[model samples]
Target: MNGDWLIRGRDGRLSVYQLSGDAVLCRSERGRGGAWTAPRTVGGEQKLHPVLGIGQGIDGYAHLVSWRPMTNGESGLVHSAHFRPHLGALDWNPVGHPRGQGRRTGAPAVAVDAQGRAHVFVPGEDGTVSLLAQKEKGGWEPWRELKGSSVQDCLAAATGESGRVELYATVPDGILHWRQQEPGAQPVLQEALQTQVRPGTLYALATSADSTTVFYTDVSGDLCAWRPGDEPAVVVASAGPGPVSAVRCDIDGHDCTLLAQRSASGRVAFAAYPTELESAGAWWTESGPQLSLDATVSLTTDDNGRVVAATSSPSTGQLLLTARKDEPGLALEAWRQV
Candidate 1:
């Protein structure tokens, strides 16, 4: 759908919201979400894959990935959705299934390159990670399994300037590994020893505009940074929540922004970590305006770092999208809208 949607408790009660030319309308089950205006139906009776994406492409179109549900009644499979704004209205269509190679596919990460092609990564059931590339001719190249250790948590990154694509994942060995695919170099596995990022903790990994520096959250609840040429990782900020919900590195220079889900308070907050003094181990910092979220949140940052989209429980609060405008080394200007 052209609008936003939220899914609750898995009773198959999916809520679809449509931003009409006028106002935002929501549609869901009569008993589930109460009687509301019948918004346009987006997905059919099929269950949503548990993830969604909406963003502009290099060709000015919109690329989306509504992850598909698992076949074994678990969690696997991802459905690709594309929206092409040709004349007046948006034409929405499905692209491909974001699956690896084996009998398992879940936790799909998607990114669009400068060529408008989609690059997706889905960790397999065997702990191996795979990559899928979609060409402009509407065909998918053979699934390519990356040469890395078994990764449990995996995410995708794409550089707008270099068209460089990378996959970041946490291996079972508690090591953070990444695979960078570029024009000349083969897919190589590089470890980040500086961050001390271990397993069992949520780590948000991002890269800078130059595609050399790596940013992520460490187990100590601090924003840590590392460069491809650096020997050790350095702490950028210690005030970040120990349980970060979402993190985006490489925002507005080499800064990293994180959306932390405070479990004790169940509130979502934002913080920024900018490393200016590379050798002196100094980094700029900023705090968000604060979002007192009543429900649990699942967070993700957009490519531009201007907005952070989060899904919350209905009984707690309405779904919201926080637009945060960063002022370099100053506090962030944040506004919440449903």
Candidate 2:
């Protein structure tokens, strides 16, 4: 799993795309860190919100969904990349057959159910949630609308026991929305079981067959979690007043979600939460480096050990992508610019 971390961003200085990931191209290895090559611009002046999903093919095709900024007046897109046989050059092809153009909210959420099919949920025009699913044979289905205007900022997903993709989002009215998807069948949509909570962004992690752990920004701008059958508990006080991201990871034998957030002063921080019920919060490592908005942190394609965090510098407006490999029984290292 040793390879260079791919940094995909629009460099305002050069006004081009700096794409690097394939081993044969510029990557060293997964565990090591290094400098990136001088990227030759290939696109226009725009921002990209991309999520990577690994496939089940022999080559394990990596699927990417790039959600364009709403101000750019562009629609969401889909792309696929894979290494050729014998470690040949990388192949990044556009396989997007989109449905329509609309405003996109936060970064798109991706989840592969138990059936090995990838489901991409994107928030678009009027806070509508659209889905672009991969077919069984070898292609992508046209973009299909899922739900109407909601918050358009929060979308979290995980797969259930039957491999059904479950999505959670919060609307403007302080309602937490939940839905479960099965192919060819209508999604069962409903409001989450109410606790003493209000409007906020959410990140849901499937911990066990009967439980799901949620970390989110509460009404008072603090980071909190709602465990199974338990009241809402504080994870990080004064956490938000900004955006938050989380990814479920195992520490020792317990399930945990690593939550990251940008503070009001621009400093970023993270904390881990146990999957099962607990009254106490784990020790958080918040004295970390600074980060900007519209940043992203996600588990690498196929739920691999790699964790990638990409952010933009507020002052310089530079996009930075960094990564750390998460091995079981170990912790992630400090963030480094790729």
Candidate 3:
């Protein structure tokens, strides 16, 4: 999802937003671990998972988008919802609709610019990528093709200076492409990057004026990175062999990164980068637990520097946890079920 947030509750608890079944849920850190705010039906229809975003503007509005299935159980449309944490309720009753029915191959990818304008991306029924945007001043633009075919079902976004958003996705051939989008400016597609970003791999992005970096796992689950125009990707963590989860968040007013990859033994390969992330292996200096989480997990951090993860499994139930900062950070607080 596009928005990265500093969601602090009244008691200073941290919250992670997620979608369960067809509803929007907010799980917050409690005494030792956390508790779930009641599930709220933000979107009337959805299947699989929805992307989440919390605006950076003064409104602090939060957003969600999901693939709405048709009567035949196929994804035919995209639906979106809005919420405000200050009000503790959904502020908008209307769902934002994409311009048309879609094959819904990819989940909605969203990002909020410095100005609080939200940008959304999704794969269309015709094998092209669709782009939608909401203005910071208000109102949504009609959906339009951003161009591409054989695109995979994953998308990522990063906002840089000058209101530009860099959107990236992997095509079937294991190559990645990115484009720079600015409001009312001519968009230019960049040359394809040979990131070797495998199909079905979860990826995260980090951007700055100087460079933009993509982080993901290879087919064998070794962590990797691609820095456009600078150099070829380097393997950050050798094949841990499982699902990858990552997020850029803030702790104590500074940027922090959280990364997790499940190992072959069902234990999670997790690390926290307190400074700008460079060599990830060094953060593994402390020892901790081996664990597993659903591949579609999103990570966040509390003001306390504790990592909070929202994850799910069809058989084991959905989970939310705060990584123990003291005990080598491998030890998890008791997880609350979603």
- Give TM-scores for every candidate, taking all chains together and pairing residue i with residue i: 0.61, 0.63, 0.74
Tell me how candidate 2 scores on lDDT: 0.48
Model number with the top lDDT: 3
**Candidate 3 stretches greater than 4 Å from native:** 1-13, 29-38, 43-59, 71-83, 86-99, 161-163, 181-187, 207-209, 238-243, 247-256, 272-296, 304-306, 324-338
Instruction: Give the per-residue lDDT of model 2 (tens digit) for 1-338.
Output: 10112322111011112233221122222322334444322223334444333222222333344444444565445444433211222333443423455444445666655545667776654666767767767677777776545544566665554556666666665434545645534345654544333443566666677555566666665677764355667776745564455655556666666666666556656666665543556554553466655443333222343455544442343555544545554345665554
lDDT of 3 by residue, 213-286 (tens): 66666655456666666554444654354435665555445565656655555544556564344654433322
Q: Between candidates 1 and 3, name the one with more favorable lDDT.
A: 3
Ranking by lDDT: 3, 2, 1
- Candidate 2: regions farther than 4 A off: 1-61, 67-76, 81-107, 147-151, 181-186, 193-200, 227-232, 249-254, 264-266, 291-337
Give the TM-score comparing model 3 with the true structure, all chains together.
0.74
lDDT of 1: 0.45
71 Cα displacement, candidate 2 (Å): 15
- lDDT digits (tens) for residues 1-338 of candidate 1: 21123322123222333333222233444443233234443434344543443323345443444444445654433433423211122223344443532233545566556666766666666677766677667766666777765566544343334665554566644444554566323246766453455443433333446554444556665555555555545544444344344445455566554444434334454444443334444443323234444343444433343444354443433554443456653243443444
What root-mean-square deviation over C-alphas does model 3 reach? 4.7
Give candidate 1's TM-score.
Answer: 0.61
Model 3: lDDT equals: 0.53
Residue 191 accuracy (lDDT) in model 1: 62
Error of 2 at 206 (Å): 2.4
